[model samples]
Target: MVNDVLAIHNGNYSWNIAFERGLQDLELDDYALLLTSLHEVHIKVGEDDRSKWKSGRDGIYSVCTYLRSILGSTESSFPWKMTLTVDNLHRKGFYVTEWCYMCKRDGETNDHLFLHCEGVRWLWNTILTSQHMDWVMPRRMEDVLRAWSRKFRDKDSGLVWNLFPGCIVWCVWRERNIRCFEDQAKTTEQIREWFYMTLYT
Candidate 1:
């Protein structure tokens, strides 16, 4: 039944007439947004329809997983902990410059300051190289944590490995605030030292 609306027409995916008429009743912006949302959805031919819980393992849903997904098991981690980056502050009507305090080359966002900034990458690379591992940084902080979780699964060593990312985040945020508010700064090496100290203690 749902496939009827998402039917293939003229060798391309097109909404049926009924769906098109329903879309006409929406406001212009909502209609456009809905179309944009649907544009990438691919329909599989001759397959049974099924539901999936993306947050769960193997597409199997459980209450515990659902709660963790919404609650964010890593809420204390860097991804959700800091929200007052320069860009966010600017968006909230503050007058701070949005440039990153660490690199000063790009706007300060959660991802840029924590993951992709040149100085931050040095910090990450230092840790990764010490572990004899190579990593491609993810676009989002949450994704970084997830990828790290998958890579470091050893029970004995995993605890420290898991703590590495959060420690880096904490150290970077402290350095950022110090520079932003205290007119103090640390070299990338100093930050790396601080990260190791935080991770071990």
Candidate 2:
């Protein structure tokens, strides 16, 4: 509820003379363009104020934005944060069974849950075959991405190819969570329908 929190007065932003003089003392007068972005934003009365983080595309904050601000973009690809597995939980000090919550056979991992689980294999194979693609499932998530990048060529086909893997991964993770946390289960067909609704809508 502070009016001058951002040094903005009467909804107008201007450099304080003392701060400008300090900047002059620091030999930073050449960086005066930093305050050029402080334009006025109109607030609509009777509307509840909503917080937004401006760094992300949708005006929502993400850890990626915070990391990039600090490290200045190393251009490193980060693993998907949305995918959760029992192994990850175990690593984080949770007492989860060290197996996939979906298949419950092999040890859970990002690679195993998304790529190598038998249930995931069935889901991927069925989806790919419906698209008239007979792809051999890759051993690792990175390999899956590499194979996907090499398989599709045309723009339309490329979009489907790009979104399909992510959709599948998301659906599988959702199903796993439902079974784990909610004690509810969904069949592959239900998952397929959810997948289409997710991407098409």
Candidate 3:
């Protein structure tokens, strides 16, 4: 699968394909991590394929090493050092349009695009109404997540409820990209349907 997306270019592995859809914030971070991890990998011609456990000193697999590799050596951070939001792009000296693509009424920021835009608010309200839950949206995305986490603790609905915010944000972001880059927009109903489809599957 990796070979399908990568190619040996000038004796070094390079990405040879483009993603079908724009990557989300977290997905972009993961992609960065992947590239970082692969930076040192060298391909040797005429060599047999063999598995080596890099986590162990002897390149041998062990239970402790395996567990440590999976658990990691330190607490993971959000890795939000940078984002692709218009505000961030402006900070990076890219002079793109400042207005929000979805609503076009406010400057585009991470919070406004994902949570606070007029259209985004309507989508959030629709989700809450479907669950018969009333919520006062917070000023920040972190606060909204904190509030949602506190409300749902049950085993069944809680899991789906916990996933709802992420699902909504992802769907909204994809729609935003479609409108910005492709000059195409999906109706609120279409966005809602896309969110539900993404959440369940």
Please report how far candidate 1 places residue 34 from its true position, in Å: 39
Candidate 2 global Cα RMSD: 10.9
Cα lDDT tens digits for candidate 1, 1-201: 666577765556776534434434547788677777777667666677889888988899987677677657654433353378977677668877669989988988888999999968888888889989888888988888777874445775888887888788888989988998999998866877778888887
Task: Note the Cα lDDT for every prediction shown.
Answer: 0.78, 0.70, 0.78
Cα-based TM-score, every candidate: 0.58, 0.60, 0.60
Q: Write the per-residue lDDT of candidate 2 for residues 45-120, one digit (tens) a residue.
A: 3457887876777888898886665556553343543345666666667876777777878998998888888877
lDDT of 2 at 116: 84
**Candidate 2 — worst ten consecutive residues by lDDT sum?**
37-46
Which residue pairs collide in model 2, if any?
A: none
The clash tally of candidate 1 reads 0
TM-score of model 1 relative to the true fold? 0.58
What stretches of model 1 exceed 4 Å from their correct place?
1-82, 151-154
Query: Residue 169's C-alpha lDDT in candidate 2?
Result: 76
